[model samples]
Target: MDIETWMRGYETAWRSNDGDDIGTLFTDDAEYFTEPWTPPWRGRDEIVRRWVERADAPGDWTFSWHVVGVDAGTATAFVQGETCYAELATTYSNLWVIRFADGGRAASFTEWWMDQAHASDGDGDGEELG
Candidate 1:
C-alpha cells in the first residue's frame, strides 16, 4: 500500500475524532499510545475506547503533520496538534511510529504526544516529566 494513502486515512480518521472510524484504520492487534500521564493502550479495542472518551470535548481535536521520515515498512511522523479538554486548551507536538502491516488490511502504529507538564510549562520553570 502507498504511504501517502495510509497517512491520508490516518489523518482523516484523526480529524473526525470518531473512534469508530479511527479504530477501523488499524489491525485488531495494533496498539496506540496516547499518554500525557498514564499507561499506553496496546490494542485497537483500547484505542477506540480511549479515543471516544476524548471525543467528549468542547471543541474539535485537530492535528497537522510537521515532518515525516519513511523507509520500507516503517515511518516516523511528527505532528503538531491541539484539543479542547472541557475548558482547558491543550497543544502538543506528537510523534508516531508506524509499521505497515504485511498482507493485512490494517497497519500497526504507536502515538507519543508531549507531556502535559511540559506543554504547560513551555521550556520554563516546571520540571519536565513523562
Candidate 2:
C-alpha cells in the first residue's frame, strides 16, 4: 500500500476506533509500539484491543501528517504528524516509523511523541495563549 493511502486509512481507524478498521492496517503478526521504548502490542488482536482501550474520542482532536522519507527496499516509511486536542488545549508532535509487510499492511510500527509547550501569557498562572 502507498504511504498516502495507508495514512488515510490510519486516520479513519483513529477516528472510528473500530476493531475491523484497525485490523485492516496491520499484518496478523504486526507489532505496534505506542512509544519508542515501550513494549509493542504484538499481533493484530492485541493491537486492536489496546487501540480500542485507549481510543481517542471523535471530535476531540485533529491530526495532520506528512511522509518524511521512504525506503522502498525495506518497505519502511517515516512520517511526521501534529495532533491538536481541542478540548484540552494541547498539541503533540509525532514521528512514526512503519515497516510494511506484503499487501501493504504494517509489519511493525513505532511512534515517538512530544507534547508541545502551550504558549502562555506573561502571567504565572497556566493560562494558554490564544
Candidate 3:
C-alpha cells in the first residue's frame, strides 16, 4: 500500500474514531504501541477497543503529518506529525514507525510523542516563554 494513502486513512480514522474505520487500518494480528516502551494493544480487536476508550472528540484536534522516510524492502515508513488540541491549548510532536503487511493494513505500529511546551500566559499561541 502507498504510504501517503495509508497515512490519510489514519487521519480519517483518528477523526472518526469509528470502530470499523479503525479496524480497517490494521491486520487481524496487528500490534499497536502508543509509546515506544509501553505494552502494545495486540490485535485489531484490542486496538479498536482501546482506541475507542480514549477516543478524541471530533473537531477538538487538528493534525498535520508528513512522511520522513520509507524502506520499501522492509515495508516500513517513518512519519512526523504535529497534533494541536484546541481545548487544552496544547500541541504534541509525534514520530510514528509503521510496518505494513502485504496489503495496506498495518502489521505493527509504534508511536513516540512529546508535548510541546508553551508559555504560561494562556495565549494559546504555542510560543515558548523565552
Candidate 4:
C-alpha cells in the first residue's frame, strides 16, 4: 500500500481515538515501540489499548507528516504535531520506521521524538536542541 494512504488512515485513527480504528493499522502480532530502545506494545490488542490510554482527546491536536523513504516493505516518515491541552501546549517532531507485512497493516513500528523548546513571544518558531 502507498505510505501516504496508510498514514491518512493513521491520522484519522489518531483523531478518532478509537481502539478499533487504531487496531486496523497493525497486524495481529504487531509491535509498536514508542522509542528506539523502549519496550514495545506487542500485538494489536496491546497497541490499541496503549494508544487509547495515551492519546490526546478528540480535537486536541494537529499532525503533519511526510514519508521520508520507502524500501521494499519498510518505510520511514517524519511527523510534526502540536498538542493543545487545557493548561499545557507543546509541539514536537517524530521520526518513524515501519515494516509492513503481507497486508497494509504494519508488523513492526518504531518511533523517535523530542520536544521542541517553547518559543517566546515574537521569537518565531522554537529551535530544536540536539
Candidate 5:
C-alpha cells in the first residue's frame, strides 16, 4: 500500500484502540520495537496486546504526522501529538520507522518519542535546555 493509505489506517487504529484494527496493521509475525534497544513485541497478537496496554483512550489525544521518506519496503515519518488530562497537557514528538511487508502490513515497526518542552519549568518562564 502507499504510505498515505498505510499511515491513515495506522492513525485510525491508534485513535480507536480497536484490537482488530491494530492487528490488521501488522503481518502475522510482525515485530514492534518501542525503542531501538528494547525487546520488541514479537508477533501480531503480542503487538496488539502490548500496544493496547499503553493506549490512550479515545478522544484523549490528537496526532499529526508527515512522511519523511520511503525506500523499497521501508518508510519513516515524524509524528506530533498532544494529550490532555487532569487539566494538564503534554505534547510529544515522535519518529517511526516501518518496514512494510508485501501485502502492505508491517513486518517490523519501531518508534522513538520524547515529550516536548513545557511552557514553564517551575520558575516564571520557560528556558531552552542546553
Candidate 6:
C-alpha cells in the first residue's frame, strides 16, 4: 500500500478499537519514541502492553486527517486527535515519523508532541504536570 493508504489503515484501526488490529500494525521489533527522555520502547509487545494499560474507553480516542509526506521509504505526518482516557479528555496533536519495512509493518514510529500536544478538554483543563 501507499503511504496515504497505510496511514488511513492505522487511523481506521484506532477507531475500530480492536486490540488485535491495533497491535498488529507494528512490526515485531518496532521502536516507539513517545517523548524525549522517555527512552524508546522496543518491541511491539511492550508497546501494545503500555497502550492497553493506558487507554480508557476505546471509542474515546480518534485521529483526524493524517497529512503524509513521503521520502523514499519513510513517511511523516501530523495527526490531530481528541481522547478521553480514564480521567482525562483532551484535544491533542502530534507528528508521527514512520519508517515502512519491506512487508509494510511499522519498523519505527516516533511521535512528536508538545506537552502531549494537548489542549483543554473544552469542559475543563488538561492536568498540569507541575
Give per-model TM-scores. Answer: 0.61, 0.89, 0.89, 0.79, 0.79, 0.67
List per-prediction Cα lDDT, in the order shown.
0.60, 0.94, 0.92, 0.77, 0.77, 0.64
- Local distance difference test, candidate 3: 0.92
lDDT of 6 by residue, 32-106 (tens): 788745788788888777766665464665556545555663443444433334235555556677777776678
What stretches of model 5 exceed 4 Å from their correct place?
73-87, 118-130
In the range 1-130, model 1's lDDT, one tens digit per residue, is 4555666776666667777677767777776655534566667888788776766442455555644665653433334443333334665566666666764325556667764546543466665545
Looking at candidate 1, the ten consecutive residues that score lowest on lDDT are 77-86
Off by over 4 Å in 2: 118-130
- Quote model 4's TM-score: 0.79
The lDDT leader among the candidates is: 2
Q: What ranking emerges by lDDT with the best candidate at the front?
A: 2, 3, 5, 4, 6, 1
The whole-model C-alpha lDDT of candidate 5 against the native structure comes to 0.77
lDDT of 5 by residue, 1-130 (tens): 4768888888889888899999989999999999978999999999999889999777776777777767763444334333334234667677888888887888888887766653335565656454
Model 6 Cα RMSD, 1 decimal: 5.9
lDDT per residue as tens, model 3, 8-124: 888899899999999999999999999989999999999999999999999999999998999999999999999999899999999999999998899999999888774345578
Better of 1 and 6 by lDDT: 6
Which ranges in model 4 have alpha carbons more than 4 Å from their true place? 73-87, 118-130
RMSD of each: 4.7, 5.0, 5.2, 5.1, 4.9, 5.9
For every model shown, the clashing-pair count is 0, 0, 0, 0, 0, 0
| Predicted structure 2: lDDT | 0.94
